[model samples]
Structures are given as structure tokens and as C-alpha cells.
Target: MATRRDPITWFDALNVVLLTMVAAACVIPMIHVTALSFSSEGAILSGRVSLLPVGFQLQGYRTVLESAAMMRALGFTVYLTILGTSVNVMITALGAYPLAKPDLVGRRLIWLLILFTMFFSGGLIPIFMVVRALGLLDTVWALILPGMIATFNLILMKTYFSGIPTSLAESARMDGASEIGILMRIILPLSTPIIATLTLFYGVGHWNQFFLALIYIQDPDKYTLQLRLQQLITDGIGYGPTVVFGQADDIPVESVKAGAIMFATAPVLIAFPFLQRHFVKGALIGSLKE
Candidate 1:
């Protein structure tokens, strides 16, 4: 049923080779980082490590877990990701659902406001002031609240909603279903793909957050993993003078830093394959818009 294409096209051949090179270029550094994380500093510095560790060890992970501050930060990051992502999904769904309906009163004006905010804003100071006024500053809510719902994500969701056959929703309404009922029964089941994709996006953003945490959280105990990891790397030799830092039984310092990076990324990477099915569907979420 499919027509065979000529294999002699010059650009097509070159494109394949170019894409393979790009894949290698991207994958190699990640491989190097993984290899180095499991290797000893001496082995790494001596150029003994490559795609694989010269001296295999689990000391990096051990050291990372042993630190009180690092452990605390890890816990906080996990808590934030779970809680923040839930809020993002719920709020975005609520906001996007009404906007997606063509018959909703003042839909255009509401959409215009959302779009305006996407392109222009009151800037950092005003947002910070509002956060501070709400007394969310220095609290866990600060990070979550500031970026709870993104306009761009809402637009993608709205577009997805628009694509769903209106008759499906109308049929529900004709069957004595309320707006809320229609949304729950008709819309949500069909919206799983886009939801999963946006969940991944929002979850990753929360996991990798740094700026707000750095600015709002002054307490050392409340720091997120990213902030704590940053301190670990920057405070490398300098958090010294009085403290030799790493306890004698603990793993080497650099190894721990490497391990932290590895661990933080592990959850996000592992989550992807599980949501891989939804991701393919998500590619088409906004495609039908406009």
C-alpha cells in the first residue's frame, strides 16, 4: 500500500547522518557524567574514566545520603513536587475547561486576558510584592503559588478540548448532565493524554526549581535539593576552615555532588518511559488549534 522512495537522494542521506551525529553528541555527555559520578576523583582527574568508570564505586550515593542538609533538602523537593504538581493540574484544568467552551459568556475577554499575561507582565517586583503581601514568602507555598498555572499550558489544554467533538459534550447535556457532569464524564476521560504530558512538564519544572527557593527561603533547613546541591558544589573547598566537612566514614565530596545530580534527575527520567504512551498523543494536543 506504501510507495517506495528512491534511496539516492543526497540531502536525505546527509540528513540521516547529521541526525545520528546529533544524537551521539547529545547522549555522549550524559554518558560521561554518569560514568564520572561513579568514578573516584583521582580516576577522573587522571583521565582514567570514560564512558565507563575506571574504578566502580557506590560511595557517591552514600555520601549524598549521609548529609543532614542534603537529605532534608531532598525530602522538601519531593514534597514540593508532589504537592505543587497536584495544584497545577487541578487549577489549570478548571481554568482551561470554561475557556475551551465556545458558548461560555465573555470567553473572548477572558482568553485575551490570559494571553496578555502570557506576553506581558507586571515584572518581578510586583509578583514578589504580591507574594509577600499574601505572606507566602519564605514558606513552601511561595514556590508553588507563583507558577501554579501557566498560560501557555492552559492554551494547549484548551486547544485539546476544542478538538474533542462538541457533540460528545452536547449529548451529555441532552441526557440531563450538568456542566460539571459533562466535564467530569465526557471531557476528562478523553483528555488523559494531554493531562499526562502537562503533568510531566509541570512536575519537572517543580523538581528543577531554584530561583524562587533561593530568593524566598532563607532558612537553611527549608532549602530545596537544587539549592542544597548548589551549595554543595560551590561550598566545595570553601565551607572549610573549621570543618573537614565529610565525616571520615562518608564518601568523597565530589562523588557526592555527582551523585546528587544523578539522583535528582533519576525520577524525572524514569517517569518519562511510564508516560511515553501519553507523550505520543500529546504531540497532537495543540496541533489542531488555529
Candidate 2:
């Protein structure tokens, strides 16, 4: 029998207060950044901006959006996100499905190898040499293929796939369905939670990618959004000049940096909820297997 527990106590009230403070600690900085991004150079220079936007000018956003290089980078970033996510889904699913099955031939050897790779890896020089050998340098495929199958995501997927009923797979086999058919028609349809989670993970990774693009993309036209934002923060820093209303004045560096951060983060923030919904269902998939 279950033991009776006391109702919410004074500690619970303290817990709520602590959680609220933690939330504010995270959120307040973001609010400050947004406010900084919207404020004038003078106000920012004087350190007057706070939780609310000051000076109320759209100049910083205009500076960010008006660049052709930034526009091109934005386009490439979006393309990379979509293309990378597609590849990630395909590779992760293919890799996970076989690993999830205990009866598959050489399963233990394959798993041992995969785990080995997780614990150790060829360093960056070796990888760069291989990419050079393949002539993948300065190409989009360079970014996509190198880090496509993240070991941890693959492990999560395999664990979730293992939770599907053995009887279901057996019934499909008895019906003369091949492994591919069984996977497509049975496993995927029922694995929405895992799929959703993977999509979000891969999508966010691609969207905010900077380091990969820095290494693999030589052309300014193909730079990712985050890279362009990074350049703006680095190159656009200057003190304010007293220019006339019709002319551009030097905007505050903090505002541009804040704007860049917001631009980089907004998409993931928008995408998080849809992805987070999948976690609980998939994370515990193996527990209820028939």
C-alpha cells in the first residue's frame, strides 16, 4: 500500500520562489539584450538602457538586415538547416533501426565499433586530410557528412526503437515483409516522438552552425547566418559620430551584438516547444515493450 504524504508545505513555497528567481536570472539578460538592441547609440554609450528598450529606433535592425552578405548567409543557413535535417533523419533512422534489434547479424560487433568510435575519434587534422582527399573542401557536403550521425542521438534513437514490441516485428516478418518495409510501414509511423526529437536536434544544430561553415565554406556567399552575425559583431564596432538625421551615425556595438544574438536564437526558441513535446514519450519508450 502507498504511504500517505503530507500536503504542500512551507518548503514548497520556498521552492517556487527559488525557481522563479532562477527563471528571472536567465530571462533578465535576454530582456536586457533586446532592450539594448533597440536603444540609441547615445543611451547605450551612457549605459542607460535596461529591461525596457530606450531611444526606440529601428536603426540597428536596419543595419543588420541591409547587408547583401548577411542576406546571402541567411539564405544558405536556411538551406543548410533543411538539407542537414533531412540527411540526419535518414542516417539516424537507418543506423538506429538495425542497432535496435538484438537478432541482427554481427549486432554486438557493430555496436562495439560504434561505441568505440564514441569513446575515441580521429582528430581534426585526420578528418581534414580525409575531406581534402575526398575533395569535399569548401563544399556544403563537407559540413553535412562530417558530423551527421551524432553518436548520442543515434543511441537515443536505438534505445527508443528497441522499445517497440517484438511481436509486431514478428508479425510483420510472418507476413513476408522485408526489414525495410517493416521499418517504413510499422516502426516510423509509431516513432513520432523520437522522429520529432531528432528533427529538432538536427535542425537547431544546422541553423546555428558557425564553426563548420568557417572551416568548410570559403565563399562569402555560402556563409551561414551565425557566421555573418559574428562578422557584424566583430567588424561593425565603432564609437558614435554626430551625423545628421539623413546620414547614418555609428550605432552602439552592444545593440548590434544583441540583435545578432536575437537573430541567432529566435528560430530555436520558436522550434523548441514542438520538439520538447516528443521527449517524455520517446525517452521512456523501452519501459512498456510487449
Candidate 3:
């Protein structure tokens, strides 16, 4: 008798099809944009470029790198991302430590207040006013301070810390270690996964900053990478007048816009792989634990 072959499951087949479609949806656009950015302007205008570059050239990258404004914006964004992510991680780690402890006084009220902010805010005008009142407007601090510790990440960190054994902290205190010492030596060492995850979160947010820079900053030199890229895309495509005139006209507008996107997205993409293991491990730390 001939052996019977196993039939393919319907759900498995459906899942494969769905996931492949989703992957293509994301990857195809990026590949298309990259190809367009490298292709000649005539090829782009004629719709000859797709996943492959037609008449490949580095003109778009050259245009982007050569512009003083673009370089300035890129530098500002790098500074902002580094400083802002540092502040975010430090503040969040410090804040979450005490909140995670069950014996801490007034913890519930503090947590409640933090949670409340997640659902409600003082509105954009009030926030802008506060930034202005504090003399943070048009400065690097304006980009960093207003969003210092995202509530969701705070709660996530707190929950992760809560899952740790309280006996560890108690033992550290018995060993003559101070609270900061325990955090530095004991808690943080074990909390690497969550820390890496939060760093990635904060870094990506700071890198993509735009609306805050738009509202608070008046100097063109102060613009972040995303804001400058936005200006390029909009102005180049004639959404409105170019913010920096005469500079964009010489380059192929579409190519430059695509190049700017790839430039902005590359760092995050490169950083993510190193931290992927931690991110995955940390993501599930607090779900089932009461």
C-alpha cells in the first residue's frame, strides 16, 4: 500500500499567505523608494523605476549631503536623540524603581496620577505655554523635556521591576548597600532586557521628532532631521513654497526626498538588530504577574 500524504492545514496556508502579503506590503515600498532615490530624474519622472534603479547615480545622496541646511538639521537631530534618550532612560529607571516596591508609601496615588496623564493632558497650547514659560522654547531642552518619561514605558518598567524578588532588595539593604547602590549593582544588572527595550523606544521617538521642533523652534538651523525632511518633501513636491529656496531646484526633488527618508531611517534599522533579543525578552516580562 502507498503511504498517504498529509494534507496542508487551511489555517496554516492562510497564515502563510497573509504574512507574506504583509511583509511585501512593507518591504516593497522601501525597495521602490530606494530604487527611485538612486535612479536618474528622467527615469523617475517617466515611471521607469521600481524595485530596481534605472540609470543608477548618486546624485540624490550628493545633493542631500552637500546642502549645509540638511547637514545642520542632521547634526541637531543626532544631538537631540542622544541627549533626549539618555534623559528618558535615566528618569524612567529612577522613577520606576520606587513605584515597583510594595512597601513604598503613597505609591498608588503616584501611579494613579501618572496613569491619569495617559488619558488626559493639559492640551497643546498649555504645553507650548509651559515650554515657553520655562525658557525652553527654541532650545534643545524643548525637544527633550516635554516628553521626558512616557507613561506606558514607566508603567511597563515598574511592572517588570515588580516581578523581581523583593528579597533581592532586602538582602542588598542588609549587606550595607544604599538604594542607589542596589539599583546600580543589583536591580539594573537584572533589568537589562527592559532597559534596552526602553532605550530603543526613546531613541526612536527622539529621532523622529518633528511637531515639537516645528512649534517651538524658529531657527532653520535648529530643525531636526525629520522636520527638514518634511520640509524637503512638501516643498519639493510643491505642497507649498520651499523653506530654503534655490537649493532644492537643482536636485531631482523626488530622489532627494527618498534619500532623506533612507538617511533618517537607517540608524534606527541598524541599531534595532543588536537590541532585538532584549526587546523580545522584555516585552513579555510583566503580562501574567499580578
Candidate 4:
């Protein structure tokens, strides 16, 4: 006999409709922006573009790509994201591994101290002073060192590590495996889900880094993508040799803005697909207790 399925409830139907609407709400704007970026000047000015590009052209992208300053910022942001995310994941994993052990001295106190940072922190001026005092100003370290270990990600990692069976670690210990060896061989190997999740989180954070770069970096050459994008949108700054004199007038300002936004956002969107399989599973598992 075939198994009978239960009929869908009204509540389930309502939830599906609501979630679909919410997803559409989030996606439609991106579609519009993309369309705007690709649409021709005439179509953009006439407001003829919506979900799809009308009279499609690559002028906006060509203008963005041609700019030296924008290219530098893109390169810098890419480097920062890769380096910063590596540091974040490694540091968080190392820190979480120790805290996951039940016998660690002052574990509770140490956790409390770390937890305190979540609720409170030295304000912006204090943080700026600390950064300055450390002589990290105008350097990439200014951006990386201060926010290396995100508190929430650390907590997630620690929780996930705790859920790993102690029997594995015990067996390793019996085999004369050092704590570091155990972590490297056993704990880390099993913690892929959380690691991947935290990697995505930290990667996104570093990719979007802007305010810190603005505050700490005085040199325009060191400016990040978001910062440069801001200048493009607000100051109406012309980019590249092509934009000089009357050439910039040929490119519509709105299209350039849309294009710039899409360019800055594209990397993260491209990266998400690779990590999405691990992301939800990691987040849910890490958040729950065994």
C-alpha cells in the first residue's frame, strides 16, 4: 500500500506565502538594481527598466572597470577579505577549542569576560585612541587586528566544539596525542560545518569593511572598495582617464551608481553558493545543545 500524506494545513500554506513574499521583497530590489546597471542611459532616464534590462549596454561597467582607483580598492578589499577571514577563523577556532574542554582553568570566568564584550565595549573614540596608540593607523593592520575575533562567531564555534563527543579526544589522549595534535587531527576535522559557517560570516564582514577604513586610513590609495564606492556616489568623482573632461557626461550618473553597487556586492554573492550548503546546517547545529 502507498503511504498517505497528511493534507497541508492553512497555517503551513500561510507561512509558505509569507516567506515567498519576504524572499521576493529582498530579491526584487537586487533585480531592479542589476537591471539599472545594465540598461542603457536612455532606458534608465526614461525609467523603462525594472526587472529586466532595456536597451542593454555595458557602459556603466566599462566605466567602473576602467577606473584605476576603483580597481585598487577592489584588489585591496579582496586581499583584506581573504587575509582577515583566515585570521578570524583560525583565531576563533583556536580559542574555541580550549574553551570547549570542561577542565580548563577559569573557563567560566574567562567566558564571562569574553561575554562581557558582547554587551559593552569602549566607544568609538576609545577604540580609535587604542588603534592610534598601537601605531596601526593608515595601515592594513588597523583594520585586521582590532576586530580579529568576533565574539558571536567565537561563541558559535565553542558551542559546536562542545557538542563533539569527548570520547574522541580521550582516545587521542590515550594514544599520547598532544592537545594541539588532537585539535588539529580530530576536533578541526569534525568541525567543518561550524568552521565553514564562521568563514562565511567573517568573510562577509571583511568584504564589507568600510567605516574602519575610513576612520583609520587617511591615504586614498589604501581606501577599500566600499569607501571608494561611497566617494563615487556622493562626490560624483570621475574615475579613470576616460572620465576626464566631457567623457564622464556620456555615462549616466544613476547607471554608474547602480553598477558600482553591483560590482561591490558581486563577490559575496558569488562566494555564498559555495558555502550555502554548510551555512544553514552549521548555524543550526552550533546554536543547539546536544
Best by lDDT: 4
Per-prediction TM-score: 0.89, 0.88, 0.92, 0.89
Clashes of each: 0, 0, 0, 0
Find the candidate with the highest TM-score and give its number: 3
User: What does candidate 1's lDDT look like per residue over 1-290, in tens digits?
Assistant: 22466556787779889999999998787788788889997897788877997688888777667667777888899999999999998789888788888989999998888789888989999998999999997889999998989877888888888778999988888889998888888898998888898898888888998899988888766789888767666655646211223454434655666677787778877887898888667766666555
lDDT of each: 0.80, 0.79, 0.85, 0.86
TM-score of 2: 0.88
Q: Better model by TM-score, 2 or 4?
A: 4
Q: Write the per-residue lDDT of candidate 3 for residues 1-290, one digit (tens) a residue.
A: 22357565787689889999999998898899989889898999999998999999898888788778878988999999889999999999999999998978998898898889999988999999999999998899999999999987887799888878989999989989999999889999988889988998898899999899999999887999888888777644564224633444566777877887888788877887898887777666645543
Residue 288 in model 2: lDDT: 47
In candidate 4, stretches whose alpha carbon ends up further than 4 angstroms from where it belongs are 1-16, 235-247
lDDT of 1 at 231: 69
lDDT-wise, the better of 2 and 4 is 4
lDDT of 3: 0.85
Candidate 4 residue lDDT tens string, 220-274: 7788998887777765445532322125656676777789999998987888789
